[model samples]
Target: MNRLRTILFATFFYILSVPIVMSVPVSALFGRRAVIRHAHVWARMHRLLYRYIMGVRVRVEGQVPAGTYFFAAKHQAMFETLELQLLLGDPAMVIKRELSRIPFWGWAAMRYGGIIADREASAGALRSMMRAAKALKAEGRSILIYPEGTRVAPGEQPPLQSGFAGLYRALALPVVPVALDTGLVWPKHGPKRPGVVTIRIGETIPPGLPREAIEARVHDAINVLDRERRDYRMVQAPPAA
Candidate 1:
């Protein structure tokens, strides 16, 4: 039954995604927000899909803001997005440029006010992210960023890149650290496990502090949350400056 349900889930996602892909060019001609509104409605459908079809349940800790904030989450599984959208509403992600180039998901991301970043571009990437984030914030939107950048397996930690600190330094907005036991269930590469996934929204840490301090604190914050609730535990602290 689970396998059949998974197949249906894949089918539903692809079928709905086609229109979003085709509509990108038209949305591009209009404005990012115009398409973003459409995408928001589209993503809501995904929540229903996960809840009713997939039977996925989510539990969130801490608080989500009505205003704007920079949200950073540990990347492990697609389950992260469900909680993010549930908490912050329409999320404009700081994604790789590759996503913006694809049909539908990529194009709609661009047309939908998502921040498509170029890691190799160096200077320009920071500026572009800030601009996109600012625009989204002005429109009463929350931004989701993955500091670890990519999903990895259980017990493995991805190196947090420097761009996260740069963006925080530039924006100086409130930062929320989110942690989840997503990899345990919806792992990067594995058969889906049946169960509820746990997530927590940490207190908003303000920017304008030292980069090392901010990054280390966020790291520990997530680790503490994940450890308390899951099989994971922190092994080492950030090296001294």
Candidate 2:
């Protein structure tokens, strides 16, 4: 029964996604903002689908910070990726450069001002990312980066990618570490369980710290949502729309 629901929901999700994702390029004929509008609409539809089809709900505990800041979030599943869009309005997401090469979505993401990072440690790629991120900061936009670079299982503690500290130093903004256990309800690539995924935003860590200091603080902050922790309150997920 669960498998059947998962299959049905997954199919519905992608079917709806084709048009939503394509809207990016179609709207590109208008302007950058138009592309972003499509992106935002896509995010809202994704949340609605998750609620109605998978029985999963999302909510935040601490207040989402305001103004231009670097957001470091724990990556446990794909759910948090969409959840970030809802949490921060039209954020400049730091994603892999490879994703920036996808067909229509890639072209739109670039036009919409996503910061593309190269995981291969190429100096030129790093330089380009820093330049893009700085420009986004100047526009007073918040930046979201998955410090671990990829999704990990619920209980795992992996070191953040090498580029995180560099981006931190380059941006020189207060870092707001966000924690969430979305994987408990939404696995990497499987049927999602029915539950509320709570995202806890820790207090901001100001800039100017040494690399070691910043990484240590971020690592501890995001782990607050790791499976072993019992520090937060859970609420009933809201009903499907």
Candidate 3:
């Protein structure tokens, strides 16, 4: 049943996607509402897949941080990305440069809201982020950031990216730490297995937590979620929206 559903969904995606991707001067008429609507539809479909098809369930324990938070989530599985999309709605995402080159899809992401950053350009990238961050917030959207940049293989911790602290400080918004242990089931792609998916909605650490302190705390929170030790209360949660 899932296979049939997957194929049907795939067909629908490409049928609508090819023209958008292949069109010349793609950005010429990309409507903001269309991109936002389409992306969330994809997310909602995946969310259903994660729950019913994959036999995975997400449990959020804390409140969602309020008033334009700087959402820093640990990226062990692609699940975090989709869950955020489903749960938080489509807040403007800050993505990497590679996404910008993916023909039609990439162009759509950028035109709508995705901020593609050149990881190598430290100062310049920071400048771009500040601009992107500001623009997104102004649009009444939140910033979704993956501090580790890319998903590390299970049991491996990706080194922290250098600019999160700077970005957090600059944004001066409440930082919400989100932790999910979805890698065990999802395993990055191909056929997914049925497993318990757990996500802990952590508390908002006030901005006064120094950048290093904030980084350390959130990283530790994620590591603890990685452990999946016990179902403890998630700290500093944003109110359930």
Please list the residue runs of candidate 1 whose C-alpha ends up more than 4 Å from where it truly belongs after superposition.
24-33, 229-241
Per-candidate clash tally:
1, 0, 11
Flag the better candidate by TM-score, 1 or 3: 1
- In candidate 1 the C-alpha lDDT for residue 182 amounts to 75
Q: Per-residue lDDT tens digits of candidate 2, residues 1-241? A: 6577678778987899898887676788997778778788878888888898788877888998768889999999878887787787677898888888998778777888888888796889888898999998887788899998888888787988878899899999999999999888888776677889989988999999999999999998898777345433233445569
Q: What TM-score would you give candidate 1 relative to the actual structure? A: 0.83
Report RMSD for candidate 3: 7.3
What lDDT score goes with residue 25 in model 1? 76
Better candidate number, 2 or 3, judged by TM-score = 2
Tens-place lDDT per residue, model 3, 4-97, is 5445544654565465445524344566766676666656666665566556677776767556787877777767776787676577887888
TM-score, candidate number 3: 0.79
How many pairs of residues collide in model 1? 1
RMSD of each: 5.5, 6.1, 7.3
For residue 152, model 3's alpha carbon misses the true position, in angstroms, by 1.7
